[model samples]
Each structure stands twice: as C-alpha cells, then as structure tokens.
Target: MVKKNNASNKSGNFKTNTIYAGDCIEAMNRLPEGSIDLIFADPPYNLQLGGDLHRPDNSRVDGVDDNWDKFSNFRAYDDFTHDWLKSARRVLKHNGSLWVIGSYHNIFRVGSVLQDLGYWLLNDIVWRKSNPMPNFRGTRFTNAHETLIWCARSKDARYTFNYDAMKNMNDGLQMRSDWTLPLCTGDERLKGEDGNKLHPTQKPESLLYRVIMAATKPGDIVLDPFF
Candidate 1:
C-alpha cells in the first residue's frame, strides 16, 4: 500500500520550491514515497541531429544539440527513462499526477514506459507553437508542435481536475487537447553574459499556467524535475 503524506502534514525531508541538484532518479529516490502531488517534467528529447541547420541569412540555427540531449542508443535512452519514471512513480502519491513534455523523438517511448509502470494516462496535449521556427532546409514539414502527456499513478486514483476553472479560462468552453501557445520568447527567456538565449528549451509560463490552473490547486506540492 502507498503511504500518502498529505500537504497539511509537513515532512522535514521535503522542501517546496527547492532544486536538489543531482541525478534525477537519485534525487527523487531521496524523497519519501508518496510525497509529491503533481510532477511536471521536461526531459531531454534525444533528437539525433545529423548536422547543423542554418537559416536563409546564413546564421546557424542553434537547435537542441546540447550534450544532455545525446543518448548512445534507443536502449540507453529507454533505460534512463525507465529509471527516472520509476523514481517519480514511487514518490508520487496515490492520487498524484505527472505531466511530461516531449517531441516525436521520445514522447511515444515515454508513454509506453509510463503505462508499463502503471500510470493511467489522462490526455495527450499538443502544444502548437504560434511562432515556430521555419525549417531552413525544407527537407520536411515544419515541426511546429510538442506533446505533453498527463497521467495519474493508476486508473483508480482520484486526481485533481478543475473542470470549471478550465472552462472559465477557455471562455466558458471546454478546453481542447490542442493548445495554441507560443514558445518562450522576449523577457521571459533568460539571456547569458553574451546576450544570447541561455536555455534552449525553456517552456513558456502561459503553457504551465494553464496546466496548473486546470489540474492542481494553489497549495498542491508540484514537483518539476526539469522544466
């Protein structure tokens, strides 16, 4: 049986709004079982980039080529995904929920593992970027969207869902799975010392705002492993 620690009862080991810097699986294992309520993950999408991409202006398009996005093979990536997801599941309460965002490179794989680990999927949302970057080479159609998978620990788990709040946000209409939100830009995006964008995959606050408003209450203990 899962030992669910409700938010009203405090635990010394867990701290809200704190980043425990270490391996994701290791860090999550340190927390008490059934402690977290909502978890939002933006894991590395192992996009195997063959080469660099450039725009019509000749400026190189700095795609997601970071070392973190690299995995030796599909097997290695799957193992990594399983480990972190297992830890996340253990730390999640019986009624807790998790949300993961990924591209075609890994979302399907992650979804399979989530089900294997007993996570009952709620919805697969498509975040259509209102201003997505154009495919410079035009080798394929513009990849203008990403998918977010929302799930509970199990099918029977009574999870949080503010349907009325969501309806209100959507102007009295039921919210659709296809969200047309823009990517993180302008002041919302962090800049480094050289005045370049710091993080390559920064999710916009508007996107998360809708997520939180729809599925979680104000005091819910939301855990973001990599957002």
Candidate 2:
C-alpha cells in the first residue's frame, strides 16, 4: 500500500518519498526556502463540462467531472494557480526545475503565469496519448494530448537535464518535444473499493518516471504539489 503523510505542521519537517495529503499551497508554504530540488505539478484543467457525456452506444462517459476540477470562473482558477505556483517557487532551490502538466483548458494561463513569476521557459512537452478517447459526439477533434511546461526558477539558474538518459529512453535518438505514451490502464491503474478509478486524472507512471529521470538525480528531492 502507498503510504500517505498528512502534513499539518508548520515547522517544514518533510521527508523524502512520502506522499503528503493537504492543500498544496499551504503545504509548500510550510517548507523552507530553497529546500526542494524539483517539483512536478498536475493541476486541474478546469474542464467546464455542460452536461453528461455519452458514447455512441449511449453509455455514459466517465469524464473528469470531479468537484476539485470546478471553479467559479477563469479568474478564480488563475488565483488558485498563482498562489500554489508562488509557494512552489519559494520552496524550490535556485538551481532546481519545475514541471507542470495540463490540457488546453488551462495550460495557456499556466504558462503565462509562470513567465510572469520569472520562471525561464525551457520546453513545452506534448504528451501524445497513443490510445485517447474518441469524441463520440463528433463535435470536435479527439483531445489526444496534454502539455507539460518545464522551467527553471530564473533565466540564469543552472538546472539538471539528463540528455543522455532521455536519448537512451528514445532508442539512441534525441527525444523531441513530442512524447508518445499510452494512457493509464490495465493493472497499472489504481482502483477504489468500488472497482472504479481512484483518481479521475491519474497520470501514467511512465510519464512521471520519464520526467523524474530527465530532471533529477537519484538522491535529489522531488516534490509533487498535486500528488
């Protein structure tokens, strides 16, 4: 079983490899400045679904309709994003890097905020899903990709980039901005007591593994604000 640590103290005594449960902004604020080596955040995409989605077979689609994904409006989401990002930056070491993933619904805003906060944009990686859900209604193209923004604390900050590791993972070729990976399914996906998915947006561990390998060392501290 995955161990979870509820971080409720303000003394910033966090340990590595332990999952923390609480508001990300508050948790990050409790950490000391320049304490984290890397951070990977998969924030809400704020997908404002009007109603239930149905497949061609009339089966209800299990879309991301969780309450956590909901916001009063764009301004509200922007506020939330800014708060967590500010805290994240405060805890990140000067040479550390950060990665954030989101869909079209919110990535643009996130990128803008990152730039405004003095984060030097590195690359916007596209996670192209090999087996994406089709748009059953045919109203639009199938959303087959999500964007990941990688950045450093500032323009001159030295950061880690495991170019050789990434090339090795890419069959001896240098990996491009586009990454092709499968969605979380089969036994890799976690299920709840009801046999349903535990998290609506549980990312594939392959994706996280690549991110960690590319940006961190074996003993470096890695934080996941949305874990």
Candidate 3:
C-alpha cells in the first residue's frame, strides 16, 4: 500500500501512511480540502515553563523546555494553535472527525477555540494515568490525567462511530468518557545515548492503538498533523 515518499524509508501507504517529520500547518495546506477522513492531533501543551525546573533536592526535573515547546506567551501559543487547527479543518472531509489531547494547562482554551470555530463536540474524554508523577513538593494534587476532545467537522456532518466495536473491546460494556491507562514505562520508553528518554512527550502506543482502531476502519484516511 505504500506509495508517496514524504520521507526516506517511509512511504505514505495508499497516501495513508505517516509522514515522519514536517511543519504540520504547511504540510496540511498542500492536502486538498475534504480529503482527510479523520485527524488526531497532539499539539503543544503551552506549559509556559521557564529555566530549569528543579526538584527540592536541586536536581533538575526533566521538562518540555525544547524550542518546539517555547512560545512568546499565551497569546502567541493560542495563535499558533488556531492556525494549525484551521489548516486541519480545511483538509478534513465533511464527515471527518478530529481528536486532540492536552493537559489542564491548555485544554480549556483549546475547547473554547474549537467551539468558536464551529466544530460540534461529540465527547470530552479523560485519559487517567495509573502511575502519574507525584507532586514532588506536595504543593498541589498530582496531575494524573489528560483530556481529549472529539468533534465532527461541523454541526450537521455525518461521522463514523463504531459503537459495537467499542463495546466489544470494553469487555462487552459500553466504553465511557474516562479511560484508564498507564504511561509509557520500562522498555516502551524511548532512550537516548545515555539511556534517558529520547522524546520528552511520546504518548503510549497502547493509547494510539485504541484510538486508531476505534475511530478508523481498514482503509480510512487518518491524518495525524503532529507526525
């Protein structure tokens, strides 16, 4: 099924395979409108963290302090999000749906902007992590979950829903909005040269496996803007 070559050693399967790396907004602009069947985006969280966030022991806690995570401020981040979302919308088929995941730091603003752009919300799912990081300083409760927003392209768009499949996957029960899953650990975690994490924010493959299987059919075109 592999065909288009956006990157070496990776072919776009029937124009459906993943593109390894590129600017999402610019890349999406090249795709024809109403071409994508579904979209899954994991945008920057706008954590707004600065300097080296350290533990009480003075050792640095690994944080998303990369260039990609940096923005001038909240307004700048919002604008960047809006631009990419608009591009995503343009490429989505009328019946196509989208799912975006984010933490408390940014999900509210994302949802508000999505509503303002006329996307009809289908559900807001909470992905609860079983072994979440504790609040080291005990200043607040442990941040243990992330939110995912599911929506259709527009109010009257016809979208795909696999109710029976979801039920079967959930031990013959209907799956709810709250999903309990574990964070990537042990061998699943990507390591760098020093045996540390290579990617700071690689989501668990299990989460994606469920999401893709639940939302897509064998040949459905899935657009992952975040790559």
Between candidates 1 and 2, which one is better according to TM-score?
Answer: 2
> Which candidate wins on lDDT?
2
The model with the greatest TM-score is 2
Rank ordering of all candidates by TM-score, starting from the highest: 2, 1, 3
* Whole-model alpha-carbon lDDT for candidate 1: 0.89
Return the TM-score for each candidate structure: 0.93, 0.97, 0.90
Residue 92 lDDT in candidate 3: 89
Q: After superposition, how far is residue 190 of candidate 1 from its true place, in Å?
A: 0.8
Ranking by lDDT: 2, 1, 3
The global Cα lDDT (0 to 1) of model 3 is: 0.84
**How many collisions per candidate?**
0, 0, 1
Residue pairs that clash (backbone atoms under 3 angstroms), model 3 = 13-17
Q: Which residue segments of model 3 deviate by more than 4 Å?
A: 1-14, 55-58
Compare candidates 2 and 3 on TM-score and give the better one: 2
* Count of backbone collisions within predicted model 2: 0
lDDT of 3 by residue, 1-227 (tens): 54444533332322555454567787787777888888999998888875776677888888788788788888898898889889989988999999999999899999988888888999999999998977877878999999999999999988888888889989999989899999999999999889989888789998887787777777888888775
Q: In candidate 1, what are the lDDT values of residues 1-227, reduced to their tens digit?
A: 32334333343477766556666676787788998989999999999998988899899987899998999999999999999999999999999999999999999999999999999999999999999988889888999999999999999999999999988888999989999999988899999989889889999999999888877877889888764
TM-score quality measure for candidate 3: 0.90
Residue 149, model 2: Cα distance from true site in angstroms: 0.5
